[model samples]
Target: MLEEDANAGYRRLFDDDGLTFGAGFPLTGTNRSTPPIEEELRLASHAESVGFDGLWARDVPTYWPKFGDAGQTFDPWVWLSQVAAHTDEVALGTASIVLTLRHPIHVAKSAASIDRLSDGRLVLGVASGDRDPEFPAFDVDRNERGQQFRERFEAIQALWREEYPELEGEWGRLEGDLDIVPKPTAETIPMLPTGQARQSREWIAEHGDGWLFYHLPERTLEDYVADWRDDAGEKPYAMAIRVDLADDPTAEPEPMHLGYRAGVEWYRDYFRRLEEYGVDHVIVGLESEDPEEALSRFGDEIIEV
Candidate 1:
């Protein structure tokens, strides 16, 4: 039942009508190690009920001691699967999971498990990781991930598709006709790499079902998309924005990290601008002092768009 409705929702957004909006996966932490899972689920359900088309989970394994922001404050897969069970329609996805740290076989199994449990409402985004400390903790080399990411991606793809497939790589070797069970209902899980991780835009374009980017000024974003399309031949593009909707409906624009604190009117205008620029999806991160208020207010305004 959940899978049926979730895929139906996916078709409604991408297969049928084109443009859609989603809230970036929300975690409540004012500089903490993690937030309670219960709170995360409540926030996720709020986004779904408020008409968010998708929810993005960030992977924040260790505190990384030095890194200031601790990202999404939970294990991405565990949190996302719990949220998936709680909601029926909103597509559950990772903003970008660091594929370098974990083995590809494990990544394949976990992702396929979530995809099946969620009834095919899964969009798995992969990246080579950015933080420096995380590598040493796992006794993995930070420098070698770029090469590993490519190899791992290939292995995971083969594991998902062919039964009893053999895979060879520097990372590890899979021999003797092993078949990964529980394939994704979709032909492939959406494998979007965040930014250029030691790969050229041309290479990224040739691959990647879609492109993911941080927030940029509307005109700059337009130019960026144009450049991406020029290199990409013809693939969809997506971007995420950190949004902090002020309680004051008339809140004016103020610069925030990767986003702006603005009123609902400006927010709508901004999304319309993205639509005009031919963007396929926009993931908004509502990071206000009061997340509930921010989500409620944004839902009343932007979700209706």
Candidate 2:
């Protein structure tokens, strides 16, 4: 298979020798059940002003109380479009949209629209549904999510790259009699699959434009990057880390959920290590009393170093 080159968003965010950073939405450390959405645009612009490369939005179609996280509390498409209007250079991304829950056609259309609106700065991270109750709520069979995920993935690709391409599978069929309009700014928008999405590593390596995974320890990250390189060649590798920045610049590393509670000095060294291990980009879920201060600190202290 011929691999597509990185889109503008990917190129801006990933380089051969260094790592780039992006901030996750709901930049404030607000309650999980009710994110402070009013702060998003201001912080998004602030992130760009401070030299962050991208801003990511989470796609939670429906909030499950049991899940305990509201994930930005807005539709990914609408949120990204709004973000795009307020910022010029920063890449806009979906941390991972639940592809299994949405129709592929809708995903394709919305993705393309965002790509055009943002002038090709959209990076789509997609995943199979992770919330169990969501499947029943959406009237989709949870058991077939793997198959549905594969089908939707292929369908979106076909819709983007082919002119009236013939496609047939679980999601439905495109018989080449019709076509989806407003193609992406590039040949296609970048699509990074999150955490295997029930597919084999081989499959993800073969199909995904890149790979997005949760935070792992240094040794595990090295192994994961090695395996990805062996199977996928030079595709980008990205991950998310939950960070609680301490006031002291030289604070020691401490464990947190999927990341660490550390200070700028530790974070700088940590990111340097990630760059050495071939991580291309990182999405940071920042924890701070004042998100603006945190974003400014990260850009000035860690990213500029």
The TM-scores of all predictions, comma-separated, are 0.91, 0.96
Which digits, one per residue and each the tens of the lDDT, describe model 2 over residues 190-281? 88999979999999998898899999989999999999989988788999999988988889999988899998889888998898888889
Model 1 residue pairs with clashes: none
Candidate 2 TM-score, C-alpha based = 0.96
Q: Which residue pairs collide, candidate 2?
A: none
lDDT tens digits, residue span 1-305, model 1: 01232333345345523568777765454435566667778888887777778888887677866777666777778877888899987887787888888888888888888888888877766788888888999888888888988888878888887777788997777786577887777655667677775667787776676677789887898998889878864456778888877667677889887899888878788788787786777788777666666777777788675
CA RMSD of all predictions:
3.3, 1.7
List runs of model 2 lying over 4 Å from the truth: 1-5, 31-34
Best by lDDT: 2
